[model samples]
Target: MLFLKSNKKEKHFFKKNSMSKKSYEEQAEVLSRAIDIAVEAFKKFRPKDFTDVHLAHFVSVYEGYKNDILNPNYKFRTLSALADAKNDILIYFQEGSGPDVNFFWKRIAEEKIGYQRVNKMAKILKRKRIANRMEMDFVTDCLVAYRQEGLISDEESIMLDKMIFDFQKKGK
Candidate 1:
């Protein structure tokens, strides 16, 4: 029991000590330096021969990064931070010699035909005003993803969300 208590105390001490109390400026400088190093390394050593599978994987990971950075609970949630993140993501897409961002989207679309079909079904249900609760939930999820991706305007997302909320609230 004494050994376990000591071990727990040691773990707590390490965990508490590991957290940095750096000012935002200091943190930003560290992040900027890390980004510069990564960019330089990528430029120096990018693979010359990647396959479609690699491209697909890259795009998938890129989308995940985009989603994460745009999430409401993201660490840097300021408007300026979001604008900078958007610019940084755009730079990554535009600077790479690997593949055009549109090509990635086209390939993704080709790969996600089922997603397309579901989206179409949602649209049809929305038009017909007959979407069930489960369908509305799916539409809400899509709206959240679309809003994060900037595929839809904030106002449009809000309007759709309101409509879905109203529909769900009606218990139809």
Candidate 2:
């Protein structure tokens, strides 16, 4: 009697949890279609002043998912991650935006061209022994522009310029 009861419970568990490969593939197809619909709607209905940063990030995530969805050895985690990304994107699109754009969306060009990002790139180039004079010159120009715009401190600008100058002194 106990054996029969356990067998019945096992069958029920399997029935509830079992999903075939075809089922998962079909679900992936549905997710891709949904992403397409959301992309179109977002492009059509978003405000004119709203920049494409969020849209670009969302689309890039989708493109990565799409490219990997058809692999014969694909794992379930990829599908799960895509679904989570989709949910977060939909939440971003749907909530609180009926009133006004967020402060993040109002950021100027100087803010977007972040000081740390440029500094990090320059440091990486120098550390990797790939810091060409032209690239360092470009970095120096960007730092100067950033200083003029108040995006970076004068001291910070001087320090970065000094770093680039030192790198350039070695050779071209």
Candidate 3:
């Protein structure tokens, strides 16, 4: 019958699409892999022993997710990597004692960094904010903050300073 034929076709389509999402066990495996990747990156930073562990964990997780966050269609791998880093960091911070204890609340001075914030900064630059001293100062402060946070090297900071100065002087 025509009805039976349609049902058979529907079942075939369903089976083909059944593997789109992974199982819980598979998700766990992916997350575990992400944690390992994050830890390796963290070790490279060689954070100071007196550095705030919570901040370190947050920074590590941010570093792990940085590239992925820029993607509009964030893949499963990205989600898993972020989740993995957060989980491991949480566990590590929960220890709450030893040399890391007193270092817990202390934080390295740094300005806030976020995806939207970065985009806004770029937009601001594209604007004619260089007409005034305040705007120039704002950009300079941001560059300095970035340097302090190790996001930009001192040389890069100096270069940007000169570039901004040139832009302001040009008055365009």
Candidate 4:
């Protein structure tokens, strides 16, 4: 009778716990899928052109999640982090094609406003080996300031949100 009672209790406990036991492999698979979706969305939805400052914002977001989603023990931020990451990656890739391909930079130069400072900051970003949070934060701050100065457009902001969703779906 005791053996039968103990077996019943064990079965109940097992049933209760079974739903939560996600294997590491399963988690990794999910993360990979999430990244794929994000990458696709970035490729599809990103503007054909963007400014260096916009690209910096997109990169900051991506760097945040590239660390968070891959590690099993890492605390998850809200879905916004993922969006930020995707947008950042998209912008970064777009900017790498040079100034001729990016109209925003040309506009800045034509206007003769904030062009020199932006160029200087871009050089700093390129030269600095951003291996730590401090360097990353500095870049982010500069980018934010550029945005505040009306350098990046509302269309760019919308693209950032799209990239976040793309990353979140992929990271899932």
Better of 1 and 3 by TM-score: 1
TM-score of every model versus the real structure? 0.30, 0.35, 0.27, 0.28
After TM-score superposition, the amount by which residue 14's alpha carbon in candidate 3 deviates from its true location, in angstroms, is 2.3
Model 1 residue 84 distance off true place after TM-score fit, in angstroms: 42
Q: Name the weakest run of 10 consecutive residues (lDDT summed) in model 2.
A: 108-117
lDDT of each: 0.49, 0.52, 0.46, 0.45
Give the per-residue lDDT of model 1 (tens digit) for 1-172. Answer: 7455557779887675454323333434433433333333344444456465765565555455455443436456444575465445444433332434334334435544221112433363457553677666556556655666676677666667677767878987
Off by over 4 Å in 4: 1-11, 14-18, 23-28, 40-45, 74-172
In model 4, pairs of residues that clash are: 34-170, 34-171, 35-170, 58-88, 59-88, 61-85, 62-85, 83-164
> Tens-digit lDDT track for model 3 on 1-172?
6445567778877765554334423444443444444344345444445356755765666455443433324354344554554444434333222333223212211211110112323444456345456556556657654566665566655656776878778875
Stretches of model 3 off by over 4 angstroms after superposition: 1-9, 23-28, 36-155, 158-172
Best TM-score goes to which candidate?
A: 2
What TM value does model 1 have? 0.30
> Mind giving the per-residue lDDT tens digits that candidate 4 earns over 26-128?
4444444444433444434454464656655554555455556555343343334444544443443333333332543344345443322224344443443
Error at 69, model 1, angstroms: 38
In model 1, the runs with Cα more than 4 Å from the true position are 1-118, 121-130
Span of ten consecutive residues with least summed lDDT in model 1: 113-122
**RMSD per model, one decimal:** 14.6, 12.8, 13.1, 17.0
Could you tell me which residue pairs clash in candidate 3?
Answer: none
Order of the predicted models by TM-score, top scorer first:
2, 1, 4, 3
Model 2, 1-172: lDDT tens digits are 7455557778877675555555656656655554455455555566445678976776676566555554434455355655565454444332223222232223222234221112443454446433676556456546654566675666666666676667867866
Q: Judged by lDDT against the true structure, how good is candidate 3?
A: 0.46
